[model samples]
Target: MKITALETLRTDEFANVLWVRVHTDAGVIGLGETFYGAGAVEAHIHDTLAMRLLGRNPLHIEAIHREMLNLPMAQSSTGVEHRAASAIDIALWDVFGKICGQPVHQMLGGLCRDKQRIYNTCAGYRYVRSNNIKPVSNWNLEGNEGPYEDLVGFMTRADGVAESLLESGISAMKIWPFDPAAQENQGLYISAEQMKKAIEPFEKIRKAVGDRMEIMVEFHSLWNLPAAMQIARALEPYKPTWYEDPIRMNSPQALAEYAASTNVWVCASETLGTRYAYKEYLDRGAAHVVMADLCWTGGLTEGRKIAAMAETYHRPFAPHDCIGPVGFIAAIHASFSQPNTLIQESVRAFYTGWYNELVTTMPVIKDGYVYPMEGPGLGVELLPAVFERTDLTVRRSSL
Candidate 1:
């Protein structure tokens, strides 16, 4: 069947709004979630990409993806363009799966494992319980800021939050304490002492949790090579699971150099999109763990392809998840289909409420493992009325 229409639903969840939607035809429809900043990707999809998607063969996922890539979106056919393409690509795979009467994972090479390993990203409750660190209201995934005197109290709340996550069967956790003081102003430069203080909680979390759980330090591309290297060395003794996004996403040469210099295995590529972009990272051996977000890397269609490519190189992949249920389930389908998956990321905040509101019949996570849903396609059906109730605006981009 030919493509009929593409739709997007943008909702205000977490600090910023995220985009999710489905592509429909007369017979079958596919679901996808776009990975982008607040108002960025939804506008791109609704405005320009949606028009191009109409009347094309929705099953021609690879061809459609390549057509979108030829457009000069963001810069050099990368950023926002890939995000829009990813949404469409994912939906196409969903349609493909439904047409064949199988889950997307089954279509992607079948299941390599019965369940996927997951780590809790919601450490607010856990951190507070175990370390006496109280997190601020709505920890925006961008870290926090307060008076120097408030550091002790914050640590206390954080300890408890960390403990809670571990108690909740989270064997590993991720924290985006880019820097305690630099939260409000991400571009603000800080002294070396301040940086040390920022990572101190992680060191404390390690001491508290010991080997009970793995801790991942998220830098959010906040440091230059020198600063990132310095911080990497400082945290080496603690033996973190990985140092994520130590530097920016540009220049594979620079990324490889920095990764080679540190004992910490550099984890990058949440921003990088598609198997095309992933090739550079793999060719350079820039990362030990390639963090590919199926939502951003062209959904299950391309996500499974990228993961398979990394597997050939003997590198493990960790699918990034910070968006809604669509992205989360899409990542699971892609991860379960690949044998090289390391661990998947999950935001407890998003999954708790927002994800529940979007779909029905999803996988259940128990004891840090996600059991695959035994339904067709992505295995979750979107509630159209819920989509309407959420009150998301589908704005068109000028492009």
Candidate 2:
């Protein structure tokens, strides 16, 4: 079916999310989403990508993905160009799955397993709610919100949070208590006091759950190599499951050095765009576990390729999902399709909270494992209410 129109939607309430809809001549519409820099991504979709996408075959996912990334600025980075292309690529895949009457994982070459394991990414209901994605400001710790105000829970009562997660059958949780300190010192150095304070959550979790709960530490790429190495050394005693983006992902050699120094697996980046960048890390033995945010890293098309490359290195793939519902669903499809996928990332807060308000369906996440989506395409759709919301902004480009 020929692509007829490209539509983008954003709401003031969810400032960092942009939803894309690909309409085809055959009357099937595919939904996709990308998170962060919503404005720029939206502009790119309508202003730039539409020219390459409109009137083309919606099922030509690879061709369109290449054409969209033809711009020099779109290469090897999760910037606006890639984010916009990613959304469209996901939408194109959705169209393909719908046309084939199969789920996206099947379209990607069928499932490798029945269910994929998951870990809770400890973020609050309103974390990163606004466009201000800086460390402290983006925390959005103003109110209690609900039971899973997990960002606060991890900071103040990590031991309790661990127990709560275990009660829900979630054995692993990701936390980033070091971000505030990193922002304060500009990632140059961390004082002994800062170091001790940052280790408190790990200490508490160990005290409460012992080895029952796996702890994943997220550094948000906010530390220098020396400081990151120091932090990794300090946490080696705690035996964290992995250290994510401990330092900037730009330097493969530097990241390799950091990985060599720590016994903890270094999960290198959701920030990277494609397999080319991941090849650098995998080639150097820098990343033990590979993580990619499907929405930002070129959707299912590039995401699956990255997963395969990681498999070649004997590294496990873990899809990131601290973003929107559609991206989360897409990640699940990628997770189940890849044979070497280790686990899927879930934000209990998002899936249980505002995510319900936006989407009509979500994957069955039970007992820390995400079951495969059964419906055709991504197996989810934007709720009718999202379109009817007062804060909604819709833009369209057509053939």
- Highest lDDT, which number? 2
List where candidate 2 sits over 4 angstroms from the true fold. none
Clashing pairs in model 2, backbone N/Cα/C closer than 3 A: none
Worst 10-residue stretch by lDDT in candidate 1?
A: 125-134
**Can you give the lDDT of residue 218 in candidate 2?**
96
Cα lDDT, all candidates? 0.69, 0.92
Residue-by-residue lDDT tens digits, candidate 2, 101-216: 99999999999999989999999999999999887899899987789999999999999999999998999999999998999999999999999999999999999999999999
Q: Pick out the ten consecutive residues of candidate 2 with the lowest summed lDDT.
A: 44-53
Per-model RMSD to reference: 5.8, 0.8
lDDT of 1 by residue, 1-399 (tens): 677666666654322334544445566767777644546676677677767767788778778877776676533323677777777787788888888889888988899898888986643311221211222333332333322112233345556556666777877877666545444445345566676667766766766777776878777676677767767777788777888887778778888888888887878777787777778887998988888876666667677778888888889989988656787888888788889999888766555545665677557887778888677788877767565765466543221
**What C-alpha lDDT does candidate 1 achieve relative to the native structure?**
0.69
Query: Against the hidden reference, what TM-scores do the models get?
Result: 0.84, 0.99
